[model samples]
Target: MPDRIRVLHVDDDPAVVEAATSALEQEHCGITVETATNVADGIERLDSEAFDCVVAGYDLPEQTGVEFLDAVRKRSPDLPFILFTSEGNEAAASDAISAGVTDYLRVDGGAEPYARLAHTVVDAVERTVDDIKHVQNTRRERAIEELHSTARAFMRATTEDAVAQITVDTARAILNMPANGVHFADGDSLYPVAWTARVEELLGTPPAFEAGESLAWQAFETGEARVHDDITSIPGRYNPETDIRSEIILPLGDHGVLLIGSCETGAFDDTDVTLARTLSVHATAALNRLDRDRQLREEREFIDQALDTLDDLFYVIDTDGSLRRWNERIPEVTGYSDEEIDEMSVSEFFPGDEHETIGAAIAETQTSGRVTVEAEILTADGERVPYEFAGTRLTDADGTTAGTVGIGRDISQRRAYERQLERKNERLDEFTSIVSHDLRNPLAVAEGNLELARTECDSDALDKVSRAHERMRALIDDLLTFARAGETATDIESVTLADIVEDCWQTVEGPRATLVVEDDRQIRADTAKLRRLLSNLVRNSVEHGSADAQTPSGHTAEHDGESITVRVGIVEDADRHGFYVADDGPGIPEDDREQVFEEGYSTGENGTGFGLKIVQRLAEVHGWTITATESEAGGARFEVTGLEPA
Candidate 1:
């Protein structure tokens, strides 16, 4: 409602038009009347200018007041129209009423009638404006509610494409803009991703905007909303020949831009911009959520792949023993489907007797942060397979114990090997008893007979017989030592290298060999096994190292050297740390280094070949490795690596 009310007064007489104008303007301060001499002139004025109400006389040059009212109804149906005529007949009043006039007034010859007409016009126009306002207010309230609904839909949208489609649809239905589209930013350009069907019908297909190509990119880069009342007047338009007269471009953060267009100029107002901005905010939030979800999904997929690649079963269990997540290996090894495993508890995979042990282990893990246990897994096919499971407790963000993450490895092959080793050890014990008791008794009787024969006849043949007996005794002792070499070490302790080397040197009968302790380091090992390993290596170096040396059976041989130096020192490298024993004697050839460790492989005639083999076996029992190489003094070197520091 404005301060001034404009009315169009149409009449056939000039005097009546002038009198009507003066009366209407003088009656109401807010009223202004413009006069037209005929119906055609009044209709022309109504089309060309804005007027609040139309006042026409019953008689005109080309048409009557009813005819003029019909013409006005075709253009502005809600505009207030009044028929003021001098002919106050029943027929004229009926026609005017039928023609949909706002009010029918008779032009009585008085200034009061004009005054009455002016008041009627003013009342009609005010009612029309009030009705229009009411409708607009109702529509605005409904639009706001619909926008709220759109926000909920955005929350449910899991993909960017879905958000784009909803944005375009919302602009068309709620904002009342049919020609709309959504453009997403891809690299250095904006591509149209979604649009309404009406948009296609109007402009076929919208063009994509490259960098600096259109106003859409400008708004997207600047994160601003732009409203173009008449796009035709704008320079550097994406489509200069396009039919769209008005456009609104809104930026959706860094994700993209939303475009709304119309064929009529100045179609969108301030309210449209405000509503569009709300929609843009919702769409941007949804897109950002979708982006984060995609990244998390990819990372989870990568972790799953890594877990599946493992040979053992990997799982995540809750505090209540329910399986929360598992790798593919679990299903493959247990012969259970993923769905079945999901419903199964952690204790259900083990036997009834083992359930208590597993529960204890899990409780310990929760307390100590880690636990390991070995139990037989009862598979779906009813087969009991031994498995060793290790678990570490998991915690939530608040540092509360959530559950356990762990791996279970099949130990069936290990169990089989252990059973085989037990059988071998039993047979070895039986053989050891035979060699110590049964063989030694007969050998002692032979030695007594040989001593008696030596007293009777002192001859060269008797010397040969004594040497043969000594060789037999040495072979039997070596056989017994080799048989028991595979036994695992039980007690582990720290021992200094220099002290062990000195003790072993005294035990070995190496009178012409000098022991050199270069660098000493403390190592963790079984004390008895480490002593045995060092004693065997020192004996081998003294007996066979020199060119001329006696065999273990007391047979003398020729040699060129009188003394050999044996060095014991630490060996440290980037990948390994341990100690080495080297002898300045005839170094083993590279071709025979690997064969020297084999049982019954020796270079000297009278040397017991089981010494080096026993050294290797003892090193392996301690989870260490030994290698034979050339020493710095052109001699044999034995390195024991992978030791645990004291």
Candidate 2:
């Protein structure tokens, strides 16, 4: 009912033909009849036109209905052939059926039999069409299943040419075409890249479909597939010694086109068109993969060239602390070539004592994402060089650690500069002590004479002179402490904090001061430097707290032991680890906290600011940070952090 079914009726009798035609016309509106009066005419009709059903009379001129059925079977194997006759016999019926006739109808003498013949022809045509469709549908389903089975193989193909040829072969087998070809677009021309079944010989030349010269161009121009039953009928179609009757052109997106041709006229069916289109999709995917792979290869090459131009030693280490790759700077810095480095691990470039430390640092970076540390790496000549190193963790798409990438910056020159600066400061400290010593002796002599003169008579002028001499002595002693601030602790050993604090308390001239050892933590330090730092802090606290503070006579005032209580305790934070010194007294002003460590920054007339400055200098020598803040009782507090504890 979806389309018209063409019926061919061949007979030697005009009356019988007229009856059959009239009956079929009245019975079936979807059927159209083409009449032939003889066997020769029937054969001609079958060859030229596509017919759904063929009905023939048994008594034909020169050929019987059975013979004519055999001729139709040879031309169209699956076309419905029917025999309608008046002289019907069992033997002749068997013959007609054996000749591949779909049905046999007896021409009895009534319109009822004629009507039955018409119905039989229609039924025969519908059944044959359904059978042919079922076969085609089965083929299509099989082809689709085969496509999935081979898809992985096609994707894994390493070469573009291999994939292209595989696509052509797959399309040819699925479509049941005798010839096929795969073409790609190369700038201005579309040329065949792979072909099968003498497709090139059939074209008489390598087919070129460019400049809109052939019907194949329509696929590229419209971005769609096209089918032609007779390719030779199109204008500018190629002629050849061999035959190629039907062809289909499928576009590989904007990349290229695929062509498949057959030798039988109108050989391609609707199923062929669908299969060719599906092949086009797979071909396009292969082409895209190839293009992207080429682009990545070029990008990687560029990155390698860029990294080689850098001066710093840039390298990548595996997750296990093994060297994976490095730049040309590696050989320049380590005196090892790329070939030798390939067999070395990153940990091999460090001393044996530091190998475990650095390895752990790299593992920690992988877990924590980044780490920065200073260490030494060894060169080929067994020389150790200090380097400032930083490592970062690299991850793949799934967010797992792929490796560790790091940069090593040599700091030998920086270390040398620091040593030179330290030598200059030590000399300056010596000159300062000599000058203070020279001035202190003259001031002491002047003070002794003034005191002797004061003993003779209580002169207000003499008292003021005596007080000025005492102040000058205090100034000289503060200058001496500031000059010796450059000296660092030479010998580091495990010393108890409480023991050091008790010893330092005896050295300061603060008899009214109270000491509280709140923490008994053990630390690595120089005993002399720790005593000096603690002594200065205690003196500063007592002088600021007592009513009659420590005088310039190197003695604490008698304040009935009512002085500041200084406490030493551990101070720990998210980023700091060390101790704090706090005092219960009138705290330093908030405005002056920032300048507390600067020389000559006095909070009051009795205060010598060099005490806090000495505290800061010794803390820096030990590589600690000192910060001043308020204590819990609204008193002054100095925190020294970033200490290595035992």
Candidate 3:
């Protein structure tokens, strides 16, 4: 209901007009009275101003109250009109009712009649407002349903042009906006792609908007929708002289802009903008989907080309063991046609004896997500060729194992190389046996003879012979260790660094040297091999760090042997985690550090030179890396890295 009800009162008598105005205004707090002395003045006020209802006396100067009501109805058909008069007659009442009067009442000499008239006027106005609202709501609901149907069509669109055309058509049919168009974004401009027939009829064909050329481009660049109630008021309109007076430019994300225009000023309201924005949203989503689909197609093509170029056989198999996809190499290697390969299962390509193995590998891949196996592939001619196949399980969206994708590589060359290495290792083992047994017996005989001569004559020559024998024995022992260290480590277990360091120190003869273990982190390694590796390093530190120690038969030191301090600590960094052994003795020269690991490389007399090399080999066996540098104490630092934590 209106907060205030405005009423126009018309009567020939000034006294009666004043009395009626006073009565009506006094009847209700919300009623306002405007006075007119005749029908002419009343009609003039009704046309020039807005009033909720009209009140006129039957005895007007120029016309009856029914005639004035007729004039009001001609301008506003639904506006409330009341005929309030002192003259009462059945014929007059009939005329008032036929003229579409909202209420007919007799103006009695009392304030109660005025109150009744005021209440009737309010009721009529509220009824009219309610009827208009019902019609608007019904129309709004229908428009919304139409928009939903149009949105479904948008989703079905397969191309950018289809989406643009649908957007233009929806604006025309649903929004009742006939002068509409859509421009797709291209490089440096928006090209007109779809437009309605009414757009061409009203303003010819819309032009393409270059960068910074039109209000459409402005909306596109800013990513904001604009409603221009009057195109003439806008400064940078594309066609200021065009017949289109109002426009709504909505940006369609990165795709383009949707332009809606009308020939009448203020033709488009808030409802029009809202519906147009909804259409633009649906259109933009469709365009994005098309773009993603196009990209996916291109990516699939690239992958197909890449797979065909593989030298090895590439294949994808379903969980049922049937082949789904394969590269060109698969058919060529198997000597089978493409159609035959596709129809056959993966186990069919292998010999009957290898089917069980291949089936097991496939089952394992499904359970573990990956597997590798070496098997023989039986060709069409019934010849078997060795292959190393690697497979990884493929999963669907729900993470169930859908199939397996993998490659099969020919392993003929690798097999041949392995055989050759096996033969070479046999010969090396034979050579090591000769050095350990055949050479050791003769050297021991010489040592026994030299000892007997020493007791008989006390000669320095006997001592030299004895030292020579010891040097030979040391060489044989080091050679044996170097041979075994090259083999890859398989028996790995976690061992504590501090325990190993202390154990090695106990075995090493370093009475004057002090051992400082800074870290006790556990590391993965073969315990026996680790013990051997640490023993060599600890003995080297003691032998080289002592000041008054004599060089062994063939071992030597760069620094004068003296009382030294050796530290065992953890080495932790971004790329590595391991331990370091550093001493306070004189460090090796930087130029000699690289050569120190080479076999038989030494600087001192009577030095075996295999100690550091054996350290390097042992590290390689465990897949660890060793580097030599100067310690903070100006001593040699050996850091062994790439260790796995226990």
Candidate 4:
């Protein structure tokens, strides 16, 4: 039931061809015959027409059938060739068969020879075509197997460098290329990885893509593979030599592109296009996953940095009241390690009733999805640490409470500062009240006495009363100055003791108090305080000493020379300066020397009990020490030392 098998007959002899065609044409009952007379003419017929089988004479006057079979094999190797000959010469038939001839037919025999040759040609053609198809199927299966294996290997790669290297190796193996490389685009720079032996020679530093010319842009615009058959002539392509012929670009992912190059033009065919598309789909998906993972890693690092930077104790707790997370500052605040905190409960941290309160609040926050206000906590050392804690529920995507999130700020120092401020304010109020009530009474009595004596007393009595009033007023002023000293501050400065002594000398009242300025007598002090201190010293010297007094032995009289004996002398004492107020008068007794500086303690009948006290207060304020002893002049000597040079 098969269709007719057409046969082309070629021979130099027409008799041999007719004999064979007549006998063989009817054998299959579905065979047809076409004849050519010579090898050249037979090849011409084959070129102009189609035939499944060819029958030719072994010997031809122009060319032998063996030669004709060789010619046919050059153009179509799988086409069937059969020789039909009248020559019974076995040698020529054997020669034709040896020269790649399929079969031979002898005209002396019946139609059997022709029928056997026609059936033989039909079987040969079918088997050759089947072999070609099988080879192609095997090649395709091997290519697919390699692609799947390469994809698996690529997926296991961890870093970007590893991914690029795997891509290049896989591309080279699958594409059968001599060289391959992967280039990553960063800004306008191209970074190459996994370079092969001939990579530099084939592809030098490629020119940067123009703003509008990129593999990503071209693929998006066309939604197809971007193939460059001529790298040297393509607009955005770079070719270092004429040998660099082909390139194929595939999108790797949102952020990158994959490029492949071949030395032979048209190497990337339809199969390559399909394979590349498949690879790109998987590569893009894998790359997207990697990008998401990198972003999440960076975000976590940022959060950790922020938490570590904080000074306060930050912690999180689970619904079971277990500490889950904390910062490094936790050990400084709670005296507990991360491992210890992990085992502790809410009650273990806050003691007594506060423990219950905090626990309830934490539970409430976990249940209600709200923030719990600050509550006091007890440390591991049993110290009542003042803390402000706020907790909120942590929920999952399902909006369920996961745990209690809290931030604990230690407010103990702030609370202590507030308490100190309150105490200071209370002390200031009491001090103001006392200054108004207790001190003003004594001042009022002294004022009334002076006013009464001014209108009711005579000359001698008035003079004595006026002197007393002046002393009382001076005492009041000194008291006010001492009170104000405690309330204010003075500017610290370098001062000259000689300048202070000169200023005090001009202000002394009773007698001549001279100033002695040495060449190097500069001192460091609060200038204003030093001035007040020296003025009081000079006044006391004048008030208590005599410029001209008879010696105890009365052996020496007053000096006849017209010079004041009362003089200020400056001298050095170790690292300090000593200013001595000396006079040729009676010396003070050793016992009363220390008692003179006590407030309201006086020896003179007209003394206000505040003169020496004022001097002592000023000396103490200026950080100086004053000593009273016998002077070189055999008189009262008040030496103020501890004077630092400016």
The best candidate by TM-score is 1
Q: lDDT tens digits, residues 1-646, model 4?
A: 2377678888767776676677666666667888888888889988777677888876776788888988998866767787767764778777777777767767555756756665665665566556655754565567678878877866777776777776766666764554656555566444455556667676564444433565535653344668777676666533244476777777665445666667766666665666666666666666666777889999978887788788877787877778778777776777777788878886787767787678778878877776645666776687778788777888879987778777888888878986886776577557655665565676678668767867786568767766766776566567665544433225776656566777777877664444445433666666776677777766665655544533323333344433334566675756877566666556566776787778787655556677667776777766677877877766677777776543
Clashes per candidate, residues 3 or more apart or on different chains: 3, 0, 10, 0
CA deviation > 4 Å runs, candidate 2: 1-3, 87-95, 108-112, 230-245, 263-265, 318-325, 328-346, 356-371, 379-385, 395-403, 411-646
For 380-480, candidate 1 gives per-residue lDDT tens digits of 99888899999999999999999999999999899999999899889889999999889988988988999999999999998888888887788888887
Worst 10 residues of 1 by lDDT: 550-559
Compose the digit string of candidate 3's lDDT tens values, residues 142-247: 8889989988898899889999999988888887888899999998899999999998898677799899988999999999999998898998888778888889
42: Cα error in model 4, Å: 18
Cα-based lDDT for every prediction = 0.86, 0.80, 0.85, 0.67
lDDT of 2 at 500: 88
> Which scores better on lDDT, 3 or 4?
3
What ranking emerges by TM-score with the best candidate at the front? 1, 3, 2, 4
Residue 9 lDDT (model 1):
86
Lowest-scoring 10 consecutive residues by lDDT in candidate 2?
Answer: 550-559
Residue 530 CA displacement from its true place in model 1, Å: 2.7
